[model samples]
Target: MFLNLLTLGVLSLLEGRFPARRDPGQRPLNMAIWLVNFASASAAPLVMGAVVAFSRRTGLPAFPVDAWPPVLAAAAYIVAMDLGECLFHRAQHAIPVLWRMHSLHHSDPCMNASTTVRHFWGDVLIKALTIWPVAAIAFRPTPSTLAVYVLISLYHYFSHANLAVNYGRWSWVLNSPAYHRIHHSREPQHYGVNFAGLFPIFDVILGSYQVPDVTPQTGLDETPRGLFQALAWPARSTPGRSAAQGVGAALKAPS
Candidate 1:
């Protein structure tokens, strides 16, 4: 928790120093979402515990990381978990049901460090039911390995930060802010590209890689207005209207 706050504070500072774009109002909304998620984070361990238990019951073979050196094991685990993240991220974009929940993350017009934790709270359970189980079964990662992954996952704050930083040639190897910003780009050309969480190698291999061209504007064309709409995003509908169209109309409606 302390580390997360420190990371958010540091990245929030960097975002101020080198902002790609500013929407001062968005930060408070992102922080509110983060607060809700932080309170809900307690349930994560319980969900993961259930996932691990289910994996054990499956009796499926897991990677023999215990036989490797500690550093090597950790490295290998990170890579595998990153691959899982990359695939699941792609699924989130490709699958409509998942996208309904995921659109909340992409709705942040001012993608900043705080936007890293701006996911809908229900995404936790959705992932627990889907990708988390697969990862648990495949890796059977020890507590230390999971802890290492959590530490590395802090890169997400940096990745989502509103900075114009990108690795030149190395952009294909690691996920930088610029690289990830494209993933959240509002431009149609950038849609469905650059979905890797930590490593971009998976994107390269899977053929979804796209170099960060310009720091494009991020977020949906029609974003949810407030916290209520954001949380109720998936279920929001009106008779004879598509969800997207309804949302668009809602945004256009008078206060």
Candidate 2:
């Protein structure tokens, strides 16, 4: 699982760092900002690992991954984890605070394979805070279980890509880029739809699944983030910030 996640993350970095133009006007995402995001968001797994290890070594059982109550078996836990992620990802869209943290990801003007790597550091911190489900799968995980984690992550990357992978019936069963592109779409209607990481079933059950009746083209269309600004975006963008900007922009007189 570790190797697979490592591979997928590296590929995401490469694509975001050296992006291909889908349109003539689109600029590649700024590398420095992307790095900050990558570094910040990617810190979670490492942090989670350190926390779990330190807890065990210090003999602190509270919040220990190994100390999870046996509420459900491993198999059930995996299924629950998928649902939890879907729910959590959806909440990032539904909740205003989470969306503020997540907006850096959508700030990418263009949607492509590389855009998947663009993220805010706060999101990474959130991920580390949310990794208990993995620990629940195992206090000491097996190779197969780890593989499952990697599989879902890779599946997640592709879902965010701007590729044209036609998955017919499978698209109904699994989350596809076609399905996921809607989540990244600038259109207001598609803004928060389709939040599944792997299993679309969770979305279906939760009534968040949305399949577009017509195909939508994908690519980066926004001005790419400048190196310094993107890195500072989360820090500077307070809840009042968005509100002030929205109201201030509206109050501006027409040119």
Candidate 3:
């Protein structure tokens, strides 16, 4: 717990020290994103706690790893975790209704550490429910699984930040902030690309990955209610905004 707090503080200071990127507080929409995600993260541990307890009580293994080799056990855990995450990510895009809930996370106008917290609780619930099946049958969730999860999450937190760090050619295998910036792109063309969380091997292999050097112009251009609206904007509707912006711009133009 202390380590996490320390990481947050240290990374925040490093970002401030090393870069001239715009801060979240300067943008109302970004602030809203932070609020929503921060609130959800506050409850994340509790949800994880419940899952752990449930796994502990209801889950049991008939045969121990006494016979199973260590290397193979670790390998299986890593494969299962990566496959589960890859599939979960794909599902988020393939399913439209679910995308509505996920749009809140993508709503960040700018990326940063705080952007990691900008997810809707409903989406988190769906995630937990979806991944529970794998956790149920795992018998004993290996340490490799937990290690990979933590490392991947840390990488994601970095990806959302505007650190401007790069791994050059390694970006092909490892996800970088610049790579994920394209994922948050406002242009419709880039929506489904860059699905891999930790590594781009999956995305590249599937022919869904693209690399561009431009920083994305974020915020849903079609909607005024982006992060700030609907949550607080009276009568603000994103569906109406996205729809009306297409057919007749002048007629729907707000004063």
Candidate 4:
């Protein structure tokens, strides 16, 4: 928790120094969404515990990594988790039901450090049921390895910040803000691209990689306007469109 707070503080400073877009008004809404999601995170351990219990009862075999050296085990865990994240991220864009939950994260026009946690509260449960369980079953990482992964994943705050940092030729190596901004770009050409969370190698291998070009405008064309609308996004009615049309529109949108 301290690490997360430190990360947010550092990234917030960087965002202030080198903002990609200057819109202070968006911060409060972003922070509000983040706070709600953070509070909801208390249930994550319980959800994961249930999954683990079910897996144990079913005799689902988890690959053993405890015998490996700490550094090596951490590296393997990172790769495995990152690959799952990349695939699930693509699914979030491709699957309509998932997109309904994920679209709230993309609704932020002023994507900054706070945007990193500006996700639907339900997304945690969705991931707990899906990708995270698969990862747990596959790797069964040690607590130390999980801690390492958490520390490394803190880069996400920087990646989503409003800073204009770009890696140029090295963009494909790690997920920099410029690299991830392309994933959040409002441009149609950037749709369904750069879905990798840590390593862009997954995006490259999966044929979804797009090198960061000019920093483009981000956010959805039609977005939830307030906290209530964001929370009720899936059930909210679109004026002239049917449910199918709304789902189709979400599927057609850029991730």
Top candidate when judged by lDDT against the true structure: 4
Off by over 4 Å in 1: 23-25, 238-255
lDDT of 2 at 101: 59
What lDDT is obtained when candidate 3 is compared to the true structure? 0.58
Please give the distance, in angstroms, between residue 42's alpha carbon in candidate 2 and its true position after superposition: 5.4
Q: Write candidate 3's Cα lDDT for 1-255 as tens digits.
A: 354445556667877887425634223554465566566656754676576667668754423543578666655655565556666766665555555555555655566665666665566666655563454246355557556556546656777666777666677778887787776666655566776777777777666677746666554543334754524432334543222212222122111
The per-candidate count of clashes, in order, stands at 0, 9, 1, 0
- For each candidate, the alpha-carbon lDDT, in order, equals 0.75, 0.56, 0.58, 0.76
lDDT of 2 by residue, 29-135 (tens): 43444555666556766777776677657665433334455433344556656776776676666566666656666666556555566666677687676755245
| Model 3 steric clash pairs | 37-117
Indicate the worst ten consecutive residues by lDDT in candidate 4.
239-248
Clashing pairs in 4: none
Per-residue lDDT of 1-255 in model 1, one digit per residue for the tens? 789889999988888887987764377778778787765577876887787787678787787867888888878778877887777776666666677777778877778888888888888776667777677777667789889889998988999899889897899988999998887776656666788898888877777788887888777665667888777877766222123422232112111
Q: Candidate 4: global Cα-lDDT? A: 0.76
Clash count for candidate 1 is: 0
Residue 52 of candidate 1: its Cα lDDT?
77
What is model 1's C-alpha RMSD?
5.9
